[model samples]
Target: MHPHSPPWRKSPLRVWLSSGISSLFELLNAANELFSRPRNLSSPRTPR
Candidate 1:
């Protein structure tokens, strides 16, 4: 592999790493929404 190769075509490992990182970020965003929103809706005391 040439050092000057284009970034996307670097190697299978690099491609997989980039994709994994993106998916991890997406998962984190989803987790943040889930935790942040429910605090108001699902409180410790039940609404009657």
Candidate 2:
């Protein structure tokens, strides 16, 4: 087997893993945004 074949074999796996990670991060970001808004709304940040 040639050296180039190893890289080709792993490229699909790398792409799959990276796409999954990106999707997970997006979900986490959305969840954080959703959960953070209510806390800010419920808490009054005005200094008495």
Candidate 3:
């Protein structure tokens, strides 16, 4: 294997693990955003 070539690219297990981890991070981020703020639905927008 060439030193510059990515070893993970050739492995199915590594790819699945990496995608799972990435999806977990995305889920965490979405949960954080959902829990962090209260949306203001009553506020009127001012036209500029």
- lDDT (CA) per prediction: 0.86, 0.84, 0.74
lDDT, candidate 1, 1-48, per-residue tens = 546877667788898999999999999999999998788677855584
Point to the candidate with the largest TM-score: 1
Stretches of candidate 2 exceeding 4 Å from the true structure: 1-4, 7-11, 44-48
Task: Give the clashing residue pairs of candidate 1, or none.
Answer: none
Model 2: per-residue Cα lDDT over 1-48, one tens digit each: 545666755798889989999999999999999999878876776453
* Model 1 TM-score (2 dp): 0.63
* Position 40, candidate 2: lDDT: 88
Q: Output the number of the lDDT-best candidate.
A: 1
Q: Is candidate 1 or candidate 3 better by lDDT?
A: 1
TM-score of each: 0.63, 0.59, 0.52
For candidate 2, report its TM-score.
Answer: 0.59
- To one decimal, what is the Cα RMSD in angstroms of model 2 from the true structure? 4.5
Error of 3 at 11 (Å): 3.0
Off by over 4 Å in 1: 1-9, 44-48
Model 3's TM-score against the true structure: 0.52
lDDT of 3 by residue, 2-46 (tens): 576677777888989999999999999998877654343223443
